[model samples]
Target: MDSFKHMHEWRQNIDRFFGESFWNEFDSILKPNIPQINIYRKDYEILCVINIPGIQQIKQIRCEIDGYHLRLQGEIELPAKGYELIQEEIIQGSFNRAIELPYRCREDKVHARYEHGLVFVKLYKDVHDSNKSKTISIEEGEQ
Candidate 1:
């Protein structure tokens, strides 16, 4: 109860001090995690859909699967051979995005295919035994 009041007062003070403009300026420094993801879960497996447009080479992308999360890091390099630039708006550098997978995926069984500038990665996960839980018998001994 006391903690809630303190938290409320703290939030009100922060809101009064910074307002909206201060928050916008602070948001400009840190890029928000943005991605178009569609997830589907079936009885057998889960499907994850991602759209990574404006990418040149699929080989430049690095993907890693850890537990139930997928870590993706890559850079979209600017194209050198092309027409002269009139208005350059798109940024060129490095970017990384992570997605929490519904299930664990096998590393070697993962397959990736690129077509029409879209990458489709197929991951296979070995089903685990979901029927057991560790139970520790505790006995309190007087010290």
Candidate 2:
């Protein structure tokens, strides 16, 4: 009876080893990259916070928002280059990430600020009244 119990538990463990969660964990360890980001949404606006370390200059980062998509591009420059790399968990080099926001944002009202090692972005949501209707005049194309 004890032998049968052991076999059952072993089979369960083997099944778990081949599960999606197990593979995801293994994949992250093998290729640990990309900056971590958190986003919050409200009726009027959306807020995004990005975690970036070892940033030398704020000018190195660039952010743009078009429609519902936001793109981030930056690099983390190593302070000392001569020393042999022993262990590195922090990802360096130029990284770009594009995220689609839940709501359509007003590009003209987008604001961004970088402080310490985190970037804060505030995007205002576009306001459109469903009951209102308007007509647009067609424009002739330039020759």
Candidate 3:
């Protein structure tokens, strides 16, 4: 029968290529690739915005604050050869994002910036000391 129909179509193409690479690495580890944030509150100050995209310089981005959390580390560089990544929901390498400061901020008056690719933080709302918490100072911003 023609070599058993070419071994059943090569075992159905090796089970559809390992079932699409095991659901694309189980949906990128249950979904979590960082980059994509937006905190509100304006006036007393408490804004944040992140959306880094394949950063190449700018010290690979890095910020930190402690009074309710506000950390962000970066690294999204991947594409050194003839591209071909069909569909990848942004997220290339090392990334760590954190934001949680409804109040209690003023780690030395935080303020960051990083145009275009986005990353404009600005916290300063101790509002008469809401149980202060320190750990700041991460400059380098503007344009």
Per-residue error for 87 in candidate 3, Å, reads 1.0
Model 1, 46-133: lDDT tens digits are 5555555566565666666554666666675566667786785454467677778777655545555555444455556646523222
Rank order by lDDT, top first?
3, 2, 1
After superposition, the stretches of candidate 1 with alpha carbons farther than 4 Å from their true spots are 1-35, 77-93, 129-143
Question: Lowest-scoring 10 consecutive residues by lDDT in candidate 3?
Answer: 131-140
Give the root-mean-square deviation of each candidate in angstroms: 16.3, 11.9, 12.1
Two-way lDDT contest, 2 vs 3, winner: 3
**CA shift of 132, model 2, Å:** 22
Over all chains combined, what TM-score does candidate 1 have? 0.52
Worst 10-residue lDDT window, candidate 2: 134-143
lDDT of 2 at 120: 80
TM-score of 2: 0.63
Q: Please identify which of the two predictions, 1 or 3, would achieve the higher lDDT against the true structure.
A: 3
Local accuracy by lDDT, each model: 0.57, 0.70, 0.72
TM-scores of the candidates are 0.52, 0.63, 0.29
Candidate 3: count of backbone clashes, pairs at least 3 residues apart or interchain: 0
Per-residue C-alpha lDDT of model 2 across residues 1-143, encoded as one tens digit per residue: 69999998886797688863664666557765567789998879899887777776666776777666777777876787789888877777788877788977776666676666777888887774232212111121221
* Winner on TM-score (1 vs 2): 2
